[model samples]
Target: MARPPLRNDLIEEITTRVLDGRLAAGARVNEVHLARELSVSRTPLREALIGLAGRGLLTAEPGRGFLVPPFDPDEARRLYTLLAELEALALRWTSPLELAGLPDAVDAVADEMVAALERGADLSEVDDRWHALLLSRCPNPHLLRLIEQTKPLLKRYEWCYFGGVPRAGESIGEHRRIAAALREGDLSAASAMLVRNWVSTVAFLRKDNGDQCASE
Candidate 1:
């Protein structure tokens, strides 16, 4: 059987499964069963699990293997807070020339997202593309890595609340503002909007999830 490259494909598949709620949070990762189900061997599956554990999606337990970390509102807040800061920093680090050039690409992504929302397609993938475009000018590899690490975790909350594109109209308007700021080479404005995008989502989750926010 052909094994998809574990570093990228496997990890992405597992992350999708987790995000889609197929691999429930706090559920134990059964490597044997998962490997069999995926038609791969144990080694690659274990490697993928370890990669996820390192990314904070799964927690390691001695002897018992990896388990999905329980959702904690405090921890979610901290992660989202850090994510906002890191993304803002990335925008600051990006070059003005590059930022000025992103409008067309950003518009394309936003258009696709809007179309997808109307079609009831996967909004997460569209959202990822939009955010990725915003960070396209960031030169620091380490900072980009940190941003990637936080994305999947934040995505869990995003899925819980937005279900891909519930707030599509408002979100499209926000994207336009961010893209316009970037086109004008206004890094400070762009950075603020980037932070607002995430922090606002956290707020939305808090408002909608209510008493269940902590458990989610």
Candidate 2:
């Protein structure tokens, strides 16, 4: 229960900014400003940026320090597909006993998503919670860590995807179906539903964005 090292904390903090669109795609990260704002020395902040760059959450240029990568629909498609497989594998690897109560837990998180939507709140946090719950029983730490690392790459797009309240509501329905599959003790069906959820998002983004590439 101890706190993570300051470097890890800094990485999460910066990743959150990127996810929420505060850092924004294609914008150069101002190391001095961030270090000052976070009340940390430049050394640790730089290290964190380097780590994020290594993780594909940030880009490192020869002389430009760190930059937020622009949102590329093709890249998003690839990441979404990769994440879908990873998550499905995680679900399959999870012990059946550990998943016995997962359907109810997932449904409860879906309820939270419903409440968030009803009040015009963002669904991203609740959505994240639901996925984390779905895979919480997976015994493979390495797979879980890979999923964790890959998710942020698509979060900015997800934030935009869920910005449409109607789309967010549709996602809730998808979650329910996945939960239902779990309730029926159908892990294969549940995994398929989960993958469909991700696939549908990718299709939606492609249609929504069309030929317009995000500004870099």
Q: Tell me, by TM-score, which candidate is best.
A: 2
lDDT of 1 at 177: 86
lDDT of each: 0.79, 0.87
Off by over 4 Å in 1: 1-8, 117-122, 162-166, 206-216
> Tens-digit lDDT track for model 1 on 1-216?
564565567788889888887888778888888887777788888888888888889889998898877667666667778898998999899888778789889988999988887887766678788888889789999999989988888767654464234466677777888988877778788789888877776655544563364454
Q: Per-residue alpha-carbon lDDT of model 2 for 69-138, expressed as tens digits? A: 9878788889989999999999999988888889989999999999999998878789899999999999
Local error of candidate 2 at residue 119 (angstroms): 2.8
In model 2, residue pairs whose N, Cα or C atoms come closer than 3 Å (at least 3 residues apart or on different chains), thus clashing, are: none
Cα-lDDT of candidate 2: 0.87
Point out the worst 10-residue segment of candidate 2 by lDDT.
Answer: 207-216
